[model samples]
Target: MADYTIRVYKNRDYNAVRMLFAEGMLEHIPATCAHVLKLPRAQFVLFISFITLLLISRSYLLSLVSLAIVFTLGRRLLTSEFHQYVESCQRDDLLDIEESYMASNNSCFWVAESNGRVVGMVGVVPRSSEVMLLRRLSVAKDKRHQGIANALCHKVIDFARQRSFKALTLETSMVQVASHKLYEKLGFQKTDVRVFPSLFGRFANFSVLTYEYKLRH
Candidate 1:
């Protein structure tokens, strides 16, 4: 509903885009923590830790305090992983948007500008000759639900269609339920699900979901 414009990424928008991405990714920490806490393994570990501490100290107060500390540390561990992911992204394709996206004929990145501010962004790269991988779709927290994300997604979809790609594919973490709903609404179908391929993810049973939108030639 808010007024905005979508355009190709430029060098000046680098800092804004990177900051938006880091913030967007970090915002999922609470959801990730909740998902991790629901796992049977996490509960079992917490229970065992509490019991062990209680047996060693023979005091309910001390045991409860220790349990709280363990819970806090667990949350910190997840937070650290999220930070590391953000850093890795900064070092990767995000380090230079122009080279990583606009430099290629089949790959590009776009950002949504509202009142001269970068409010949303999305990118696409060829996965094969026929498939395009949609990546880095993010909208500023305060500017969401204003059709920014929807527009960005459509931009990629339109680009893929124009480029004669067969399908658009993307992967999102399990905790991103809202993102899943958005992708499904835009006609993407769930194709696969897999563990996150990290020690924390394995221990917490964290997973990622892949979705694909096929285009008609």
Candidate 2:
């Protein structure tokens, strides 16, 4: 396996995280669009209109102008109240699995870096005296299947074990089968189903699957 370093995220690493998210968003644009379709009607209309403008503009100057408008509108849409609501839902989901890792407590966050560039990350938050919740596990597309996630996960598991955590829990969506399989391969067992109210309210209905792993000394 290629050597990589795992460390906590730093203030300077914020940009790297943003870039990674942007790249992942672009990679999953089709799925992202499908998710966007679940937005409220008004939001959907605005989003579709922007896409229509991007597709229909012909002349170079007109296209550039339309692109600029689209970008401005896109930024507004991303930062709008509805968007914030959706983002909060996501954050809540993450917290539901693990909240202690968010700049507080004895929780831990690890980022996998190779040649000085971040390639993956995992977040763990203490849930109780003997359990921790793991969330936001991700690996860049180019780094997938290369053990980056495995290494990061192992590091967190080791940290938790050393701290005397007896169990680790996580939640993953059906859309993320690979992640589910990874968790299973890491010795996690299916625990139960989690229902996020915000997700159900937005997507009409969806399921969040939960998993757990018992640590052994």
Candidate 3:
């Protein structure tokens, strides 16, 4: 068990939150790239493309080089998508805490402090009058699985219920199995899943899962 304090997010926590989110999300890229590449469709396409190159070039050396280049380019494209998401988060949310989350009274953000340092974060924003969207649940890499995530989750649940929100909901990627377990433990149900809509998303073919917690019932 880590000794920590959980409290409302402050302007000073911006850099830490951004850093944690980026590092955590980026850590998944290697797994994500391999996941994408291992798909039957992905492997088939790569194989077909390589064979075409071999026939055209008719040089075993050049064909192997071309195949390697394709693998590199494909991985780069998938990795860049993750980078772009982190950049978008920095631009939209981390740029100004007050204006983005704290501006509206219904929306609130919080952080967990361990040894006087920001080590975890979670936030709730209004999706509608009766519902709140729980977003960006992150804990420090070294400090995870020590109940910090559960504590932060309980804090947000209490906050939303106190505000009379009917339900709390969140979106997460399918690869985030750990997060899924945490949300499930907290009584959120898997309500929906959608394919990533971005161009890179189409190629990667991974889907996002949405979870919901009905406060009243």
Candidate 4:
């Protein structure tokens, strides 16, 4: 078994983390669709049917059906729009780090590594003197369920407490029930809904639920 470790991200780890993010997102697709389709096999069949129809039929009806299936699958597949959003989040995180560095305030990125390979990451930013924002929490599928996210959250909370921050906050989609439950178990409370402006202009109606956790020092 490979030994897993969690550490602060270094500049050299950037490429590895980006690769891991792509892999993690792809791994999450099936589970994301399963929540809607309620059956993995059925979803697979529908996906195949959509592709077949797209290749064979020029009928407006078939194209419409294909479009619907694509919409359904794309939501779960982490398509270009989703990837762009995640990239935007990463850029924001880096910007936060740069700003904090300039101001001489502490900010850091953390990653989970197994056998010297990056597998997961979490970005933490101080929102105010008393609050921290937790964003971009992700783990490779194979490394999940081993308490990687739990450990990462705990570490960030500890870091916040050490810095005397009063609370931590995060936003996640309502469709991500497993993540919602995880945050709840970690003592986070849902506080509001957050509207994420779409970069692709396609998923403009989507919103994410926000949660907060108070850290008692």
Candidate 5:
């Protein structure tokens, strides 16, 4: 088991939280790309592209090369999509954690520290008067599956219940298989599923899942 303590976010933990979130999100690119490739639409597009190249160049070698290029472009598109999310996060809530999460009773952010180093973090923000959105849940790659994520989740759950919130909601990418399990294990129900609105998302048929955990009063 990893030795760590969970507490409210502090100013000193800013850089660590930002780094962890970015790394965590970017780490999913490969998995996401793989998921994309498995989609029938994606496969059909690749097939069409390969066939077009084969006819145009009349060379199997050139067609194979073109197929490889298509794969590379798809991966790059997903990479750009993830990067854009990270940048938007940094520009918004993450830009000033204190202001975004610490200024009000309805919102809060917390981090898990092991030996004074931030190893995990999670935050909750007001979605409405009775609901809170759980955001920024991330654990260091090396420190994952040691109960760090579970602990962070419980921290948010406890906070929400104490605040009289009716429910806690969160969203995760379809490629995050482990996250889907974690949320399910914690009693969150799949409330909705929607395709991500982006060039890569549309092309790959990528989607995001929304989960909600209702607090029992």
Candidate 6:
């Protein structure tokens, strides 16, 4: 909260950026679990399964076993989802950030510095000739409630405009409610909500909300 400056990504800030991203993302697990449990399919399956087991055996042990099984399945499903997202991040972006972002003239990464330390970071990767994906935005946990995130976002938006991008967009999980607020405050509008396809996506049952900031003349 004292003072912070936003600057282009430096090689030295890579590790800090990675750590901030991992920590910020991992913080969503609990929220994701709660959201998953509230889904209609989860409630129906858990209730029916438990009730059926109770009526068939009436044994507390069997009922508990059934509960454990169902709960474990849900937990494992979410854990797998978490890992998949993390792996995708590492494989697609974080692993070779320089090669993935720095090497390209259209892609750029930035970090927020305070007290001479990397406290926050954000990046923009060109998704098409006219669009950029605003991604990897995060701030240190202890550094929240400050203006670091806002500054980082402003910097990314300016960068996009200066580079003639037509729009800036991002995807965030439903669990990332706080981020949604930030994006909205920055003039990004929620445009869509979608879940990934395939068995794992069905089992885990999470939705990603997409937001877009259309640049205007």
List the global CA lDDT of all models.
0.94, 0.69, 0.88, 0.72, 0.92, 0.84
Candidate 6 structure quality by residue, lDDT tens digits, 156-215: 788889899999999888888888898998899999988767575666566789999998
Summarize candidate 1's per-residue lDDT along 1-217 as a digit string, tens digits.
5599999999999999999999999999998898888888889999999999999999999999999999999999999999999999999999988999998899999999999999999999999999999999999999988888999999999999999999999999998888999999999999999998999978877889999999987
Model 4 agreement with the true structure over 1-217: per-residue lDDT tens digits: 4367888877677777767766655554555444545545546766777667867895768867776866665574546555765576557644344343224344567889898888888877778877898876888877878888898888888888888888999888746677899999999999998655654232333457999999996
Selected candidate, larger lDDT, 1 vs 5: 1
| lDDT, residue 195, model 6 | 78
Model 2 global lDDT (CA atoms, 0 to 1): 0.69
What would the C-alpha RMSD of candidate 3 be, to one decimal place? 1.7
Q: TM-score of every model?
A: 0.98, 0.65, 0.92, 0.71, 0.95, 0.88
Residue 11, model 4, lDDT: 69
Candidate 5 lDDT, 6-75, residue by residue in tens:
9988899999999999999999988887787788888999999999999999999999998998889877
Stretches > 4 Å off in candidate 4 = 26-78, 94-105, 199-205
Q: Least accurate stretch of 10 residues (summed lDDT) in model 1?
A: 200-209
Instruction: Tell how far residue 192 is off in model 6, in angstroms.
Output: 2.1
Give the top-scoring candidate (TM-score): 1
Ranking by TM-score: 1, 5, 3, 6, 4, 2
Worst 10 residues of 6 by lDDT: 196-205
Top model number, lDDT: 1
- The digit string of per-residue lDDT tens for model 2 on 92-165 reads 53333233354565587778888898888778878888998886778899888888888888888898898888
User: What is the C-alpha local distance difference test score of candidate 4?
Assistant: 0.72
Over the full model, what C-alpha lDDT does candidate 6 score relative to the true structure? 0.84
Work out how many backbone clashes candidate 2 has: 0
